[model samples]
Target: MLSGFFRLEYQNRTVLGEWKKVHWLKWKVSIGLSTIN
Candidate 1:
């Protein structure tokens, strides 16, 4: 049971990390585009 809980937590962390990376990239892209225009 403890192992399952740990796995779930790990998965959540990974997903959150991926989301943050994607959001960061999106922000950078938008800023770059704005600057170019």
Candidate 2:
């Protein structure tokens, strides 16, 4: 039971990391576009 809980937490952390990366990329793209315009 403890192992299962740990695994679930790990999965959530990885997913959150990916989500942050996506948002970071989108932010950079928007900044670039704004500078160009």
Candidate 3:
């Protein structure tokens, strides 16, 4: 039971990390576009 909980926690962390990276990329792209305009 403990192991299952830990696995779920780990998966959540991985998903959160991916989401952060995607958001960061989107932010950078917006900034770049604004600068170009």
lDDT per residue as tens, model 3, 1-37: 9999999999999999999999999999999999999
Count of clashes, each model: 0, 0, 0
Candidate 2 has its poorest 10 consecutive residues by lDDT at: 1-10
In model 1, residue pairs whose N, Cα or C atoms come closer than 3 Å (at least 3 residues apart or on different chains), thus clashing, are none
Model 1 stretches with alpha carbons more than 4 Å out: none
RMSD each, Å:
0.4, 0.3, 0.3
lDDT of prediction 1: 1.00
Estimate, for each residue in 1-37, the C-alpha lDDT of model 1 and write its tens digit: 9999999999999999999999999999999999999
Q: What digit string (tens of lDDT, one per residue) describes model 2 on residues 1-37?
A: 9999999999999999999999999999999999999
